[model samples]
Target: MKRGLMIASALALCTAGCGGGASGTAAAAPVPAPTPAPAPSPSPTPTPTPIASYTPAAAAIPTAGIALPLGKCVNMGNHLEAPNEGDWGRAIAEDDFTIIKAAGFTSIRLPVRFSGHAAMAAPFTIDAAFMTRVRHVVDLATAAGLNVIIDMHNYDELMAAPDANAVRFAGLWKQIAATFAAAPATVWFELINEPNTNLTNAKLPAIIAPALAEIRATNPTRPVIIGGEGWSGIGSLATLPMPADPNVVPTFHYYDPFAFTHQGATWVTPTPPLGRVFGGAADIAEIDRNLQTVRDYIARTGRVPFVGEYGANDVAGVPVSERINYYGTITAAYASVGVQSCAWAYTNTFRLRDGDHWIPGMLAAIHTTTTLR
Candidate 1:
């Protein structure tokens, strides 16, 4: 979703790679669909609603649907990498965390770009003291009864480069994983943020293993999320080298027809082509394509697909109706398929368009309990 010029929606901004600060990732090309098939929705309703502030013991592989207890997870947004939280990228305002939990989101995806800190080494290992700051915020979120997905935000900048950079990136994960080995189940590891196609499954574990192994060594049962190549785009999901452990889930970002969704993005080639408002048929169309990938993946590998990131930015006078429809379509799509999703973010960038305690109606896609059950 990188745009050449910022669109003037009521919302603010985002965080993708590094100082390279390109438009956030466009979904990498999806692997070819096997045979177009009808889309599927899981249609699950918990016998008892997942309790708020409930913590479950960490499991190696999570149960595949909404029944497992993960309500809805949104991003902590700017506090980690946006200009507002620049130093060490470790700060989190208590108010921000409260806003998220209050909004009905049960989890927070904390993406941090540690490389910005001068203290980082070549492979971009996060500094120790900075990690303490990270742990502190994590404590705040978990204490608030929210699940946390600690992402290694952006490391491929060094990874795509040669020598010490790759080593540093690999080592950075090891350091992080080792540090949080004892973290609660609510705090899961989302290995390296989004990777490019160049990182084939064959080569993935090599870079991922060192870090994953570090975590497994300490907490073998904790679920760890891993994304596919093609900048970890949904299309690239089919090629994922999902970890052997059942607790592992294959993850990818969903931004279809990037040309449309990322209309003005400069980092992307051919920029975004068609211009479509958020929601309805486009939502259905988007979900259709998504479930095709999910069913296709399930048919082929029996593994489930989850959206690590998916949402529309409030740019270019994008209507609240459009946002609401878009999110509604998304919620229905995921609910029907039984896909467990973590929507885009909740912050200054691509945020929920807060109107005091109320998030904008357009962003309030979750109009029903079914959306998160």
Candidate 2:
């Protein structure tokens, strides 16, 4: 017998043969089994729209003069880059600018997380209050005679889904450019920071051109910085694409001999091993070779390079003296080549300052440029 027929017969027999209560009410008709619903069809994936590419003009505009003012810089990190100003434990204070100026620093690279503070939909508006807050910091830095490089930092969504976010990225820049339009030339823009993942060397030019266009719409001729994929490391620069615009500056970060510079850095996967102290003849030679690679790139491209970030971690396992030696070596090497550099940070990881004062000898280690003093 069929399974359904067998079940029906078994229920019928029980209903007929089983005795009812003394009231003799017939057993209620056996409830029917419910039919299962059909499975849902899967939604189709949306195809990504292709982004337009840029071609540099026959004669590239010179960027060496554009990149000179950012001497002896330092990143004011772990502040506006956080989801909230103080979420990373350091907020930009008014006096912070005064202190930075007193330390002989000529520029401050202010990193802001624009995506986190902006709407993700059409028009992609950055919050007005947050924009104002950023302006306040910029005004404070410039007033103290510090050149401010307002960098678009930590846009995780764009790195993950470039095609989906490109328009929004451009939208955010449209607002940012207009906001700083009237500001002096000392205020600069770094289009995006540490691009990686879906933002490949092949895709970066398409991504940068639109944002650069937006900036030029209002602030033409202002210097804008751009870095390559793979977290802006030296290897990344090998294929970095530049838009035809003359004022764009090429940037890269260095933490070479990574095992030593990033020792005990909890954030890096498998964490670089602890106790990898720096300062050997081989170590010194490696720094020289890397800076030479930068010089070679500059010679080939006429775009003066900026060391946007370079520092060794201040960790429990490494002595302060060794860290200072590494800083002195790296900064002096870049200065020798006339490539301006900004250390990793002021008061966070790889910090030059502690509480209110700079770590002992840390300021002098990086103050290798006579122009900076």
Candidate 3:
């Protein structure tokens, strides 16, 4: 399940800075006062202009300049996103990158729950030790020639109390952006994992605007990913506020026909009914309809889409054959629409592995180029 940190209010904050002033007694400037000007009227205090809120417009959406290979990508989930390394039952090993690359994946999305390793107070400093560990993992992926996407994951606190946590949320990105300022272009930043709760379509722009500005200040041209409201669901794609930056890539998650993908998944509220299956003609048509929603959005906005997360839970009790078919069909659908994607996980629940070995059928379903190993 996605986790979050409870952030404190920042209402009492104050800013400090430098100022200069000058004063003089009666006789100080006698030379220049020959034609003494009438008593200078007090300069009217300048009225402060209220900052204009950002309104996303279609004309403002720039062409995406950065190209992320849309080919096979996988999520290194349940690792860094956990409370600690190995706590989620899978500690990422350096060799994992090698395996990912060798298996034909061109990128890996690293979901990190930064709130767990950050200060709860102002400045919200991320734990240095945690950052070091993240850097090491990033280095591993980059060295293996796989593009790495670092994302803020499971920040439920920010979602629930967006107004109060705005400062801390921006602070978190400010630190993250600065920390990865010098990272290679292959290293990408995803603003946040999934924006839900009070951070809905209507309120998303206010929260993300400052965060995007914070990131742009440091890594100006880096490829940053932004998702829509409602857990980044495809239905919300049209309503997502697109930033003016050309390097930004819009993303959405796909677990369409939720009953089929999340069947028997306990984490999902009112748990999805089990025994749901995929691969029939009707199922394929329904999947196509969902993919078309994304395709239409991309065409309308001219912003490339990235399917950030997609997968079926292994324990959903659907037959392995149906799961394989689902993965293959969805992967093809994504390819058809020219959208990039990363499967749900490398290990843990909804994983592609059973213990240390690759689940042959699952691997083949994801990477069509390779056979079962």
Q: What does candidate 1's lDDT look like per residue over 7-115, in tens digits?
A: 2211112235211011223342211112323322222322322111211122212244212245576766556654336432334676667767766778888887666
The lDDT for every candidate, in the order shown, is 0.55, 0.69, 0.66
- In what order do the candidates fall by lDDT, top score first? 2, 3, 1
Assess the local accuracy of residue 20 in candidate 1 as a C-alpha lDDT between 0 and 100: 9
Residue 191 shift from truth in candidate 2, angstroms: 0.3
Give candidate 2 misplaced runs (Cα > 4 Å): 1-65, 368-373
Give the number of the best model, judged by TM-score.
2
Residues 1-373, candidate 3: write the lDDT tens digits: 1112111111111000000001000000001111223332222233322221211112212244444554678888678876677765668986899988887788889988788899999899999999999989999999999889998876768867888988898999999999899988889999887666567778878888898899999998888888766567776676888777778888777766565665554443334456666655566666667767765776687776767777776762456776777677677666655565678778765677777777778877763212110
On a 0 to 100 scale, what is the lDDT of residue 292 in model 1?
Answer: 68
> Residue-pair clashes per candidate, as listed?
24, 0, 0
TM-score of each: 0.74, 0.81, 0.79
Error of 1 at 86 (Å): 4.7
TM-score: model 1 vs. ground truth = 0.74
In model 3, the worst 10-residue window by lDDT is 21-30
Write candidate 2's Cα lDDT for 101-178 as tens digits: 988888999988888899988799999999999999999999999999999987877777788889999999999999
Candidate 2 Cα lDDT to native: 0.69
lDDT of 2 at 224: 92
Misplaced by over 4 Å in model 3 are 1-67, 367-373
* Candidate order, TM-score descending: 2, 3, 1
